[model samples]
Target: MQLASNKGLTARNDNPLFWSLRNAFVRGDTNGLDRELRYSFQSFLLRNKFSKSVTASHKKLADLRYPYDWFPATRAMQRTIHLHVGPTNSGKTYHALKALENAETGIYAGPLRLLAHEVFARFTAKGKPCALITGEEQRIPEGTDRYFASCTVEMAPLNKRVDVAVIDEIQMIADQERGWAWTQAVLGLQARELHLCGEERAVDIIKAMCARMGDKCIVHTYKRLNPLRTMQESLQGDFRKLEKGDCVVSFTRIGLHTLKAGIEKITGRRCAVVYGSLPPETRAQQAALFNDPNNDYDFIVASDAIGMGLNLEIKRVIFEAVTKYDGGGHRVLTVPEVRQIGGRAGRYRTAAQDIKDNHTDTTSRPTSKNAPAGMPASAGLVTTLDDEDLGVVQAAFTSEAEPIKAAGILPPTFIIEQFYSYFSEDTPLSFVLARMREMAKLSEEFQMCSIVPLMEVADLIQEFPMSIQDRLIFLTAPANFHGTGQKQVLKVLARCISENRTAHLLDIEGLDLDILDIERGAADVNNTQYLQRLEELHKSITLYLWLSYRYQGVLTSQHLAFHVKSLVEEKIKDFLDNLSFTVEGRKAKRQQTRLLVERHRKLEEKILGDEPSNEAELVQEGPGAWSEEGHEEALMEDEAEAEDPVGLPDAIREVVSDDRLPRPAGEDVRT
Candidate 1:
């Protein structure tokens, strides 16, 4: 019977333990059965233990599970926290707003007036009391606990009270022209929670800053919602095969228009264009037309200005040229610029499916006979634009004139030092101190002066042989500082100045110069007879010095030996009305001076007030807070009358004030 039971167990595909237990039971041995059952259970336990260990090892290799040591701390911190950090089109703005919708009070600080207006409209649509504040506009809702301010850093003080403050495009904090405002906002904004959004490179810097401030900082990276597909071949061939909904990106305005015209000719559809020089309304209209799926415009020709934040429904992107003429010289495209523009190729909603089918070839060969080797090839994605030579120009205006030395590139240290030499030795170190005095002097003397003198100086400096000219070139060389067409225009201007000819600035409004060959273009310029006249003028020391000061290598080059002569043949009129100290009698002269000063003050006010055209004058308000009594009353009433649904306890309320909120308890969120 035991043998039969064991045989039955074996036939059922049971384990050896099952057969052992079955034989014990069949023998009617209680103690044996107990022993066999315990042994069988012990074997099952050992198998489970081995299986668990293997599963755990796999999880560790895959990083599928948090470590036992780290999970508890991470999980606790993850509960009340939110993060906003990513490249453009990564839904940073969307996620931040979602968090704001749940918060009791929220504030959004945007970079531009127009952006602030857009955000104001969005919040207003949600039935929230929102405010829009820019240098040109301000619409603050009275007494509302929640507010939205789309203001630069200068306006940060106005948004003193808020639960959460979101700083969009935190990368602007490093901007040369307006970085101070962003930096001030980050350091000075008084909010319980700060949410920053920008490029990934800015993450570590922001985290470090937050950590120094003793705030807990957390970083979150969001993958690109839409990634561009690779080009099968380079984009150097015939572009007729370009599908519908393609964007042809160009650097120069002329190039943009030329491509738009060419695309329209080929596709039989009107092409839209968005460039920096275009009016805001025109750019917005073009953006809308290009984004519209059913619109007659099937293509867009744009500059890098369209590379950020502008949403487009595009299937392909064509880079007509990879290089752009930065004001100082030609520069190659950086990875961020390429990624920003190329990232627009596929639509965010259908990236995976659409990107595969939309893959086009991008080739890099010598351009065709008519095309110039416009600029250097792009340095691939992830390459930083923070070259040391470039950093010198960025930090030039500061007191610390860090000498920029780069291999293969000319050092701009001597050039910058020469330019700064214009200031007196006693000059203050602060830009603000210098600016205040300059503004006061300008207001007293040249308040109504025409811009022609400044323009002339800029022109002469372009031809100037002094090293300072090189400094100016380096200063304006960056892609963002100057337009892509600036290099060609500057070269033409320099050639004209060298020949001593009156060079008429080309009006680019409707010109199609991009199609012209560079060699042919140079030949045409030489044929104008202006070159001969300019060369003759260059022999004079005055003209030579003017050119030297404006151009960099001219004065330093050993091949060029030119003496400095006064260039001003015509008497240069001083813009300022100089005050004279002498008079026939001392008392009479003093009285005359006092009367003149008062008269000048009134004239200044009237001139400044009337200077704007009718359209611009429409929104002018007398300088003051300029708010009506009724507005203030309404604000007070709105704040005093509102009900507090949260019934926030005294413990929290004590820390909250009219101008600032209580600081948040959780780890600080860094972009």
Candidate 2:
């Protein structure tokens, strides 16, 4: 009672509940004390209502409903938006890029690094001063000050003003995992003319956004140059009937290699394989081999990586299955996926080819828009390997995809930092992220992106004594914890950061030149541990490169990391070239699933205790506590979704632009 009085605790409206309760207690009035306690409880509840309890800072951080307002410069501009809406192989991107090519100053933001690389190559070949920027690398041409910039969407410059900007694959605004990048680009890019190229499905949503911005919107509809037709009959799982120009699509890396082997065995022609896990350069090489008419490579075995506008000289698309395992479980392919992948079958005159031909034609030879000069256009054909998948493919092509309703957004680092300031210094980063998610305020037009991956990273680096800003940097790194060697590499880097020591390429354990040396190739690619190690090593090097750009001095071996990355990629390519694996239907899947379950069981056992397990502590205490060796089976089956490629945050952007080292929080903002 005395303590309560000192703290100015009292009842409302002269009720004197605290005093009454004290009086009751002193007089031994049990009923009065109970009544006073109930009244006091009600008073406390009324006083500490949700609205009253929430601080102004908490409300400010949670109110992410108006993302447009975040970019004041972009919002101030009255921009012109050109919506180039069409299906694949429709030359939609061609017209948009043409405008960009002619512009004095421009930027082309694409979804994939491959696309950015392609644009950079095209512009460089044309002798245009262009710069390429992606999460992994940046290549700036000599004697240029941003005349043209080709970058992954996340890396698009929001602060710099450009005359024209092209945001390719605008339909990705609805993508669950990476939609926020597209959204950020669309909402934040400072451009006089913005070209948005994508499917017709994104038209309304984009128009709605433009209307909200009070910008003039122009829609340009495009038709495919080559007609696409769904075949009436399936291949009936017959590899012998597969044609030379056919592209067989499968979901898994193992499945891709198995299909390649099976197709080669029956057809007696070399098959080039492409999948997501493979490096982009390797995939491009495989595509080039399949495209070259003089080469013995005829058929191409690929994953959905081809769906992302990978221009291959494919005559027909044969779907091995209409479903894929998306982290959680098997789900039917969406209309957009089916359309995008199937659309790659026969690109009569791709944007790149068109640009090349036009540039080389010194005699000014005129060519038809639909087909190149003296070349007959081929129609794209779609079919299924098995009889049951045909209907699914047909239905997906004919049906319309649902219109995108909302754009994905993440709580910016500054907002996160503001929220973190309210918590104790000892509070776990994961706890702060969880609380933010719980208290998030979103409107119907916007949705918060999944921060589960961030939470996982936070948990991994929880024991490290690092600043909030440094921790955010790691959390945003392109490290999927479940990836084969990613967790191991991340742990090493985190320890170095915590200890304020520079991390060298040699500091990483179990990764050496001997490990990456693939003299020949694996006999069995499907279940081989060596091939898995190479892939893991490739990812590890890529992660290092990504970190190198952000923590320049801290991760000091960018040159060595790039060299090792190339070596790993070459080894992987060699492995693919010599692989001759035979797999029955879904045999590899079962094997991998079992292995993943067992490994996960073991991980659970290690972490299951009175308190949460410190992953960093485990790494320091145990040699291979988190090392994912011989778990190629788990690597093959239970790969987590790719982490969101974080772009240059406002603070990081300033440091990068200035070409200086990171400064203190007072001097420079948090990343």
Candidate 3:
């Protein structure tokens, strides 16, 4: 029998723990054996204890109503919650935020990064020390005392005790995708005053949940400040009448691009586009362009992304299609979505610019007034191309919004694994989350959201033999999947993690650290695919910042990461803004963003000033080649696959896909 030299088995043999265990067996001394057993036992015991506590918690939950308050973070705290409820632009959040601003120590958690950033910028500019903590970036200034913190809801600090905690878009607690973050924030935040801000739909459910948790809840309802009314007449796809304050809505990326390009080409007016895929920097810039009355970017093309948080002065919102792909299938826009996006058409204008004229409400529906109830308005209109769905839009005002039940949840990665271990080997990842849900019912700490993403990448991690820590890093990495080459970027990160180190730009082979190295992505951005690469690099910089925040001591290169982030942001902005500019001109003016043109030129001259006349200052180039680390390893494995292919141990192979291993000549690759 020919014995195969298995790669996985070889790795297993070389592991330090494996050697320790082997030594215990070989040595006749009982102490050595006992030492190794204790290490293993301790690890298992820690995990097992967590499992038991969660299981017991679930059993007891059946007898109690307050499943959320059991968490140690919230145990001593009898939360005093103030519910600021109203429609969009009703000043609910604005007033709630005023309360947050007055508090000595506070946390403002918003559903979107843009919203958190707005709060961060507003607070910081007001000279009130503020720290911005999103998933990928941390902007905490030095020498600031008791700084206010603004963060994405998922990044909300559970342990921190604040004078006030503000949760924006509280209606999202009913959202199947992100509800858990709102839920966790509401349940875990130990604030003296917890402020929930959103529409009236979430009011009852929030009150009920707070009541059950034994917290005091109060409701503060407000009327919209501006008059927002749907148009009496629909556009019906008439491109001839496209005007300056018109925002055309599309559902998908292709739709946004096509509509934008076509509208700009026909109307000869620059169109500012806003979609979910655009980086937050680009989105803000585009919005600024559209908002400026003096600018030629009069027309706005956007997705549902423009519906929330963006206070735009859009005179009309034209829906291209009422139906959109909601992951599974194409479906009509929900009543909430229709109303929300339509409301943006007639935005609350500034105090100086008054619209004291008659309301612009067009439809004959009793509620069809451009002005909201009890609020005076000017001209604001919402229309659609397809008249068949006009009735749906018309009926949106009276549609009863759904009540939020339990919040969605995603337990920490290790907890996910522990719960996963209990299920049979043949069980799918779907069941892992299903099991998590059943388990969370028993404990506050274990509350898990549907966690579809956890399932999506589970197989990808399983493909490689990785440590639990490595698996967790990959799973939690906030890398964008499409267009961006984040998958390749992730591979680089995985290799560094496997080697037990953090990656820096210096270690990335081709990356240059010189401040004036704008040529790094200068050439590539010309190609269509370069945008994706640039996006990936941008995301990679964020990944570094994220890791630095997590393990600050081990990954002490956050400063370098921030510098790179600025460079990449400049490159991306230049590429998007100056599509018509010559490559050389674009490169020369790339650093002109952020109002630093003269300063950038002076810095460039200074760096080159000390160098020889013939030499450029920061032109240290890579060998001008791109290489992926795993390619060589895969090639070597391919050679082995033809002869003595290695396979994983049955223990792991039973649960994980054996697809990573080479298949036999007659065997199906997938199976």
The superposed Cα distance between candidate 3 and the true structure at residue 8, in angstroms, equals 47
Top of the candidates by lDDT: 2
Model 2, 648: alpha-carbon shift in Å?
47
The whole-model C-alpha lDDT of candidate 1 against the native structure comes to: 0.40
Identify the superior model by TM-score, candidate 2 or candidate 3.
Answer: 2
- Residue-level lDDT of model 1, residues 528-553, one tens digit each, is 22222221232222222333444434
Give the runs in model 1 whose Cα sits over 4 Å from its true position: 1-83, 101-106, 111-114, 124-129, 136-146, 152-159, 252-254, 275-284, 325-329, 349-671
Deviation of model 1 at 30, angstroms:
99
**Candidate RMSDs in order:** 35.1, 15.9, 18.9
Query: How does residue 133 of candidate 2 score in lDDT?
Result: 87
The residue-level lDDT of candidate 2 at 348 comes to 59
Q: After superposing candidate 3, which stretches have Cα over 4 Å from the reference? A: 1-67, 251-260, 273-289, 292-297, 325-330, 350-379, 385-391, 412-448, 462-474, 480-488, 506-541, 552-671
Q: Write the per-residue lDDT of candidate 3 for residues 1-671, one digit (tens) a residue.
A: 01112332211113434433433432212334454465445444443435676666434432223446446668588789999987765667767877897899999998666667767867765678989887767788798667789997878888889999999878767554456667779888989899998878777778777776788999999886655666556665555577677898865443455567667766788988875445566766887787677779878888775665665667778887565534222235677778777777766542112112222332212212233334334456678754554666777755765644335455655455665565455544444443343334322222233344554455444545555555666566564443335555555655665566657656764232332344433553333445445645765666667766766655667888888878776765555443331222211221111112223234334432433222111110010000111000011101111111123334333322322335455432212
Q: Rank the candidates by lDDT, best first.
A: 2, 3, 1
TM-score of each: 0.41, 0.76, 0.64
